[model samples]
Target: MAGTTDSGTGEYGGTGGVAPDRAGPAAAPPAGTAANPGPRRSSWRYIGPGIVVAATGVGAGDLVATLIAGSTFGYTLLWAAIIGCVVKISLAEAAGRWHLATGTTLFEGWRSLGHWTTVYFAVYVVVWGFVYGATAMSSSALPLVALFPEGPGLKTWAVITGLVGLVFVWFNRYAVFEKVMTVLIGMKFLIVMYVAIRVAPRLGDAVAGLVPVLPDGSLLYTLGLIGGVGGTITMAAYGYWVNAKGWTDSRWMKVMRLDNRVAYITTGFFVVAMLIIGAELLHSSQIALTSGDRGLIDLGTILEDRFGVVTAKLFLVGFFATSFGALIGVWHGVSLMFADFVDRFIRERFGVDTEDMVEMVASGQRERSFMFRAYLLWLTFPPIGLLFLDEPFGLVVVYGVLGAFFMPFLALTLIWLLNSGRTPAQWRNGLLSNVMLTAAGLLFVVLCAKQVKDLIW
Candidate 1:
């Protein structure tokens, strides 16, 4: 298993409480064994956790954000989407690194950082769960509302979809969950690719988009594009997926890095294709994309006008798949993060070692097996009430501002933790990791300031 001490290092002096060996609850697979045993799949199964992470992170707001950018700034902000992918890749790799290096859940790492982290996360997860629940379900259900001729209102369908997610995540094992997510991700990718290919812009403009340039009157649009590349609370979920994939030990580090890199490369391509569809089909048409998932609705109209109903419907399927992928993702993944948070500090914090700590928590020796499902249900439903009841401007503003706090929290914590001596000498971050995460921290603080300014007087 990963969290265990390196066989080469005699660092523990063997005074240890259950001597550190393979790190977390799920033991790492033997070093030479391929984790996903199947037909001779050429190294792609390693892509599982990363693809799930990507699908979970990108959502209706993200897609809508892209559509609005394409409508307002055309290909001008394509660079930002790609930049966002780079940022997420860094963060995801760090989260995965912490797991492999420390043999602990991310919550364990956060507790080491300070109680403030645990407390901040606890509060953030709850509030974020409530707000995100309604938004995700409603967004997923919107496409259903459109596609079904006599479909119910989005709220009605939202409630039903939320129920479905709750039940789906309730019973499935890790591999089953990953496979279902893969299928949904594939469908969404096809729809986005179809729109982009059918309506590709002039070759000159497409090449020009490869160059970085900000459009006029689009500062806010540019900021959003940079922020919305493809990441979410699920970036934190990377650790859980790492744990679930039997990649918990440090030996899996190389494959984990490759997986994170390839996954976000796929994400960059996905967002860029959406941008091309917008730039080619809607940029000059003077059709504005209003805020929210409705922006994708605007794209569907442009798609329908340009390529007929089939293509438009394909895009709608893409919207549902992307939105609901995020929905189930939060339902399963974030709940693990939240459960780990509550279970780590609240239940087993008797200066417990990571292995015993996690074993106690996972084996129902702790009180919050129910807490995980509580948060999951919180994420999957309850907030459906808010779907019918409009959230006030103050609430939405608060949600936005609260969200601005997480990126900096993640960036700063990773930089400090990895630099600290607690990290094994070999696993300590190199100059590139330090530079990238530090830059991410500073950029996030600036983004936070901008979000605050936008929200305040």
Candidate 2:
């Protein structure tokens, strides 16, 4: 079912994307001392990628989920939100490990798994990107439209935002992209953290939330909160970000771990802040909002009424920062993914060799590649139509199903890849990793099933 072609620059080695150069066993470094050079760098230096992942992964929907959790169960579910960060930390760390240990992109790692993995991912990015494009733009636009109501309609703002994100990612390299995202994250943290503090979170109640206690009849919501706090397909993109950040060697493992923790710690703070808002604002007032992005708008209105217009506007701006940050992050990170996917697919299906394509991508050269721009267009232009019309019910259902399954897919696959011989032995999963990944896998499976059932029923 494969063919041969001769249309590539001959960078990798063999035809069809095979790098005879890279196919041999990875050079295993001593435990904790592989490719790392020099005395260990300060942990602060390795922080960009995690911020990108955190900014990308936690969007409007996640905040809504956290807000609702706090609104429904008050501070009781706070532990679940923190646990969610821990789970994601394990997943992201495993992903970064694969790239560092194996010296291959995650897509390359997936290809090593089987043709099925490649095919599944190919189908996934296309479908997921199309739907997510509209959703992200819309989410980003909500705050913009809120801020400037008379300027344009939501669809217009969505289109403009999409185009802006497209241009921004289409032109910038990883360094600039990271810098821009950091600034936006700074704005996001200032607004959300400020609001949370202003809400006057109860110290005793928050401390009690650190303990694991579920309120009556709230088990599923608690699980959803724990499982949903700051997860997305973007977690898979973490490794690519790691590679993009020039941390390809295993020597950077320690820094990567610290970076991952800081990323989720930031995420945990945002989630906790939203929970504080929900508990103190909604729970105390016995108010409930509708779910999803609109729920955020409702929350904005509530904030304005209770606090003031300035607070409401600030929160909306934070909402925009979170959403737009995700927009550009996915635009850049996933484009890198799709470009790798395309190059590898060509090699697999058509036998064209690109030689050092992995290096090309990891070095941020792919940001300017034709395939990366094509997928960027694919993510941008096609979804603008969805902003104009209602999303088709069937397509919506399929998107939901695929979205539901992605995290579990990531969890199980990381577990498989890390434990297998494909990875350097020294880089394989530790017992703690195995335990956490298994637990994450099971939790996501249950969550995925529930999502599918909800869609069907």
Residues 287-398, model 2: lDDT tens digits: 9898778888999999899899999999999999999999999999898888878887887787774555545653456787778899999999999998888899999998
Q: How many clashes would you count in candidate 2?
A: 7
- TM-score of every model? 0.89, 0.91
Task: Give per-residue lDDT, candidate 2, residue 105.
Answer: 72
Q: Which ten residues in a row have the lowest lDDT in candidate 2?
A: 1-10
List, residue by residue over 186-207, the lDDT tens digit for candidate 1: 8888888877888856767766
Largest lDDT belongs to which candidate?
2
**All candidates' lDDT scores?**
0.74, 0.82
Give the poorly placed runs of model 2, Cα more than 4 Å off.
1-39, 354-359
Task: Compare the candidates by TM-score and give the number of the best one.
Answer: 2
Q: Candidate 1 — what's its lDDT? A: 0.74
